[model samples]
Target: MTAAVDVRARLVDRLEASGVLTPGWRQAFLDVGRHEFLPDVFWASTGDGYERCDRARSPERWLELAYSDVAIVTQWDDGTSSGQQREPTSSVSMPTMVASMLRDLDVHEGHKVWEGGTGPGWNAGLLARRQGAHNVVTVELDAVVAAQAAANFRALDIAPTAVVGDAAHGYLPGAPYDRGILTCSVRHVPPALIGQIRRHGVLVLPFAPLFGGGAVARLTVTGTTVTGTTATGPFTGSSAFMRMRQQRYQAPPVDDYLPGDWPGDAVREYTTLNPLNVVDDWLASFVVGLAVPDLYYRRSNNGGSGMTTLWLFDTGVTSWATVDFVDGASRFEVRQSGSRRMWSEVEDTVRWWTAAGRPGFERFGLTLEGGEHRAWLHQPANPLPSPRGQD
Candidate 1:
C-alpha cells in the first residue's frame, strides 16, 4: 500500500479507538477518505495566520496534512484569492469534529438530509454514504466553492445535489428534510430551517452568539417551533467555527468607542471579580454572551507592563465598559458609560453563573418559536435571564 493510504489507515484506527467512530459510521468513515475531496492547495491555521500547503511541491507533507486531524482552508476570501491569503472563507473541518457531528446526527438509512456549507464535498460524501446519495442535498453560498464541491462529488461518483445560494434560505426544493446539519456557525437558528424541517426532525447547527464563544446545538423541529440542548460535553473543547457568510461579525471602529474627551460621562468603580477569570473561560463567556445580547469585547495588554485592559461594547455603540487588570491585584477597576451599564451586566452574569455552580455549556438549551429564540438553563421551562433586564 502507498504511504498516503497507510496514513489514512492510521487515522481511521485512531478515530475508532477514541470511540468517535461508532459501528454505524465506521463503514462510511473508512470508505470515504478525506484526501479525495481536498484540492492541491489548502491553508492550515498557525494560530496567528494560515500557511499554504501545496501537493506538487511536497506530496508527503500534503498527505501528512490531509490525513492529520486538522481543519484545512479550501478557499480564501470567498475564492477571490489563490489560497495564499491567511483569511479563510471556507474549510474542510477536522475529522474529529465531523465524526462527532455525524454521530450526533444519528441518521438512518433512506433519510433525507440537508447540509449547509458544503466546502469541498467531503462531508456531503460521508452523508451520502450513510443515507443514499439521492437523499442528501448540500448548499453553499459561495458560487465558486459550490461548483468545486459539485465537481468533487462527481469525481467521487457521488450524486448529491449541490445548490449555490444563501444557506440561511435553505434549499426549498428539497424541503421537509428528516435531518438538517450546518457545517458553519450562525448567530441564531435560521427561521427557514425550522419551516423546512418536518415535525420530529432533528437539526444540528453551531450556535454562535454575537459575542465571543459558541457551542453545537441539536434541536428537534416540531411544526414551526424547535427546541434542544447543547451537546458540548467536557470531552469536546470549544467548537468555534467560521461564521456563515451572511452572519459574519461587523464591529464598529475603535475611534467610535473612544471619541474626543472619552469617558466624559463614564462612571468609575472597582470590582473584586477579575475579568480574566470571567471572559477567559469558554463556557463562562458563552453563557455571558447569551445573557448579554449584542455584547462584544476586545482585550489589549500594555507593552512591557503587567496589565491588561478589557473593553466591552454594544451593537448600538451607545453603551461601553472598560476593566483594567493589574497583575497580582485582588481587585480590578471598572468604568461604564451610557444607559446599558455593560460592565454591571457582565458582573451580574458572572455572579449568577457562580451561584448556579458554574454550569457547563451542555446545561444550556435553546427554544425557537414563532420566529423568536429563547435560551434556557437546565430546562426549557426555565429561561435564561435576558440582559435586557427581563426574566
Candidate 2:
C-alpha cells in the first residue's frame, strides 16, 4: 500500500479506537479514500500550523490532509478561490463532528436520509455505505460545489442522488425522509424540513442563535411538530457551511438609520470579551439593553495613533458605536436614528430571559406551524409568565 493509504488506515484505526466509528462506518472510511473528495488546492490544519494543499504542486500535502481528521476549508465568501483573502464560506466539517452528528442521527438499515449542504459528499458516501446509495439524497445550494461533489462520488463509485438547489427548502422530491441531517449551521429551522420528515423521524442539526453561539440538537419529529434538546459537552469547533443566501451578507450600514444625538448616556466599557463570548452571553447583553436602551457604545483600539473599529450590526438601526476606554471604564456612543429603540429591545429580551429563572438556551424551544416560527423559553407545561413590560 502507498504511504497515503497507510495514513488513511491509521486514521480509521484511531476513529475506531476512539469509539466513534461503528463497524459499518469503519468499512465506509476504509473504502472511501478522502483524497478523491477533496480539491487540488485546499486548507490543511495541522497541530503545528495551517498549510496549503495543492494536488498538482504539493501532492504529498494533499494526501496528508485528506487522510487526517481536520476539516479543509473549501469555499471562502461564495465560490472564489483566490487563496484565503475572502471570509470562509464553506468547508468539509471535521471528522469528529461528522461522527457525532451521525451517531445522533442513528440511521438504520434501509432508512432514507436527506442530507443538506453537500460539501464534498464524504458524509453522504458514509451514509450510502451504511444504508445503501439509493437511500441517501443530498442537496447543495451552489451548483459548482454540487458538481464537484458529484464528481467526487463518481470517483469513489458511489452514485447517491445529489441535487443542486436551496437546501433551506429540503429536497422535497425525496420527501418523508426517515432521517434528516444538516451539515450546516442554521439560524432558524426551516418549516419545509418539518414537512419533509416522516412521522417520528430523526433530525440532527447544529442550530445557531440569531445573535450567535451554536449547539448540535437532535430532535424527533412527531406528526408535523419537532422537539429536542441540546447535546451536552461542547463540540466547540467551527464549521464553514455556506450561510443561507438571504442571510449570507452582513446587514447594511447602521449610520443611515441612526440619529446624530438622541441618547441619554452613551456608555462604553472595554474588556477581554470576544465576539464568541458576546454571542454565548446573549442574554446578558439583552438584559443590559433593556435597562439602558438609549445607551450607545462602540469598540475601538489604537495602534500608534491608528484607530480600529468594531461594530455591532444587529442592535437596531445602529451601524457602529463609538468606543472609548480609560482607567478601566468603557463607554459606547450609538449612531443610529430609529423609533425601534434597539437598545430597549435588547434589554427587554434580557429581562424576559432573566425573570424566567435565567433558563439557559436548553430551556428554549421552537415550534413551526406552516411558514411561521415561534420561539419559547421554558417547557409548554411550565412556561415562565410573560413580563409585564414586554412589547
Candidate 3:
C-alpha cells in the first residue's frame, strides 16, 4: 500500500472515533481520494499567516497535509494571481468541517443534492459516491476552478454535472433538490436559494455575521416563492469558511473615518474586560456578532511599546472606537467617537453573553424569514436582541 492510502485510512479512523464520520458514510469516506483533487501548490494557515506548500518541492509533507484535518488554500484572489499577494479565495475545506457538514446534510440514497463552491471537488466527489453521480449538481463561480474540478472528477471516473456560475443563485436546471450544501459561508441565507428548494428540504451552510465569528447552519426550507419562503435550523457547530465571493464585505478605508489626527473628536473611557478574551475566543466573537449587527473590528500593535489596540467600527463609517491593551495590565485605555457607541455595544453584548452562562454554538439557532436573518438562543421564537443604534 502507498503512504497516501495509509495516511487516508488513519485520518478516517480518527474522524470515525470522533463520531463525525457515521457508519453509513464510512465507505464513502474511505473511497474518496482527497489528494486526487489537490493542485500543485496550496497554502496552510500558521496563525500569523498562510505558508505555501508545493507538491514538487516537498512531496511527503504535501501528501500529509492533503489528508490531515486542515483547510488547504487552492486559489488566490479568485484566480487572478498565482503569487501570494492577497487573501485566499478558494480552498479544499478542513476535513472535520467537511465530515460534520455531511453529517448535518442528513442525505439519503437517491436524494438529489446541490453543492455550492466546488473548490477542489472533493466534497462533490464524496456526495456522488453516496448519492448517484446523476443526482448531484455542483456549481462554481470561477470558471478556471470549475474546469480543474471537472478534470479531477473525470480522472476518478465520477461524473457529477458541473455548472459554472454563482452558487448564490444555485443551478435552476436541477431545481427542487432534496438537499443543498454550501462549501463557502454567507452573511445571510439568500432568498433565491430558498426559492429553489422543495418545501421541508434541508440546506446546510456556514452562516457568518459581519462582526466576526460564524457557525454551520442546518436549515429546513418552508413556504414558497408565492407563500414567503423561509428556513429555520440550529447551529450544528463552529466553523470558519471563506465568505461567498458575491457576499463579501466592503469596509470603508481608515482615512475616510479619521481624516486628520488620531482621536480627533473621539470620546475616551476604560473598562476591565480584556480585548484579548473577546478577540481570541471564537464563541465569544459569535455571541458579540449575533447580538450586535453591522459591527466589526481590526487590531494593531503600537510601535515597540508592547501595547495592542483593538479598533471597532460600524458599516456606516461614522463611528470608531479603539481599546489599548498591554500584556499583564489590569486596566486598558479606550477611546470612542461618533453617534453610535461601537465599543459600548460590543462590551454590553459580551457581558450579556457571560451572564447567560456563555452558551456554545449548538445552543443557538437561526431563522431566515421575510428577507432578514434572525438569530435566537435555544429556540427560534426568542430572537437575540439587536444593538440599539445602527448605520
Candidate 4:
C-alpha cells in the first residue's frame, strides 16, 4: 500500500507537470484510490497486443500499473470470454487522459456531473470525491462491469449514483446536468446526451470519425430540442480511447468487397503520393477522416519484403481501393473499383490539406446538431471538404 501511494505521488507529479492536472482535480486524484476500482486482473498494452497482469501472481507489477499513466483494460469481449479474446470492451483509462478530459470538463463547485461511461468508476469516484458523491451520476452499459464498479466504490468509501444501462442513451433520471463527460469515444454524439446537459453546459467527450483516429472534444451545449440540440466545440488534443460499446465499428470483411482475384474489377493506376506517410500519422488520419467520414482502411504487410498494401473502403459498400507501397518507389500502383475512387479522394484531400497549411487537431472542431455531425476547421461555418468534392 505504501508503494502504491508513492507510485501515485509520482503519477500526480507527472500529470501536474503536463499541465492537465490542475489544482481543482489534484486533491480528488490524490484522495480517490485508482487501484481500488481495478479488477484483480487487467490487460496492459504491449504494442502488438495486450499482456495480462494478475495481482495474485505479480502484486508489485499490478500495483505499479494501477497508478501508472497507461490505460488498463478490465474487460474483453464484454467479459464473455474473460479477456481471452482481447477485444477491450471496457477499461480504467490512462491517468493522463482521465486528467486531460477532466481538465477539458472544467467542472465547478457544487456542479452536478453526468458521466456516460462508468467503466471501473474511477473517473466517477474522482468527480464524486470532489463534488460530493450525491452530485455525480455515472452510467455503464455492461451490468457485470457496473456491478463490480459499484462494489469498488463502496470499498473506496465513495458512492456515486451508478446506473447499469447503455451510456449512449444516457441516464435521464438525473437530467439537466451542469457538466457532462463520456469516457468512451463516439463517431456521433448522442442527441439524447445533448438533451441531458443544460444549455451552455459543457460536455467533454472523445469525437472519433469512422475512418480512423480520434481526439477529445470539449463541447458546450448551444441549443436544445425546441429547434434542435446542438453541441459545438473544438478537440482539445489527440486521444485513442475505446469506442462506445454500441458505436463500435463492425467492418465488413475484405472478401465481401472482392469476391474474386486481386483487383478483379478495380482500374489499375499509379500515383506519386505514398499513403505510408498518411496512415503513419494520426493528424493525417484525422484530417482525411474529416474529409471522408464514411471511409475505413486496412493494411496487409508482405513478409520479409519490406513492402505493404494499404486498403481503403467506404461504409456505403460502393467502393474499394488499394495502394501497393514499395520502398523507394517514385510512384505506387493503385487499384480502385465501384462508384467512388477512394485512393484518388485520399490523394486529393492530402494535397488540399497541404495547400491550406497542415492543420493539427487543435484547429479542428465539431458541431452535432439535427442528428448529424459536421467537422470544420477553425470554426463551424468552414466545414471540411466532402470526399466526393475532392474528386
Taken over the whole model, the C-alpha lDDT of each candidate is 0.81, 0.63, 0.88, 0.88
Candidates 1 and 4 compared: the better one by TM-score is 4
What lDDT score is found at residue 68 in candidate 1?
83
In order of appearance, the predictions have TM-scores of: 0.91, 0.76, 0.94, 0.94
**Predicted structure 4: lDDT:** 0.88
TM-score of decoy 1:
0.91
Model 3 lowest lDDT segment of ten: 382-391
Candidate 4 ranges with C-alpha deviation above 4 Å: 46-49, 225-227, 253-256, 302-306, 389-391
* Candidate 3 residue runs with Cα over 4 Å from true position: 45-51, 225-227
- The stretch of ten residues in a row with the least summed lDDT in candidate 2 is 228-237
Off by over 4 Å in 1: 46-51, 81-86, 225-237, 254-259, 303-306, 387-391
Name the candidate, 1 or 3, with the larger TM-score value. 3
Task: Please provide, for model 1 over 1-391, each residue's C-alpha lDDT reduced to its tens digit, 9 standing for 90 to 100.
Answer: 8786688888888988998877788778777889998999887664656667899998888889898888898877776775256467889988988988887777988789999999888999999988888999999888888888888888879998888888898899999798899999888767887678778778888888877688888887655323332221111335878898888778889678768676767899999989988788878888888888688899999887999999999888888889999989998999998778888888888888789998887788777776667788888887777554323
The segments of candidate 2 whose C-alpha lies over 4 angstroms from its true place after superposition are 22-24, 45-50, 81-84, 225-241, 259-310, 313-367, 370-390
Model 2 over residues 140-238: C-alpha lDDT tens digits? Answer: 988888988998888878988899988888998899799998887776668777678887787877765444445565667655423432111122223
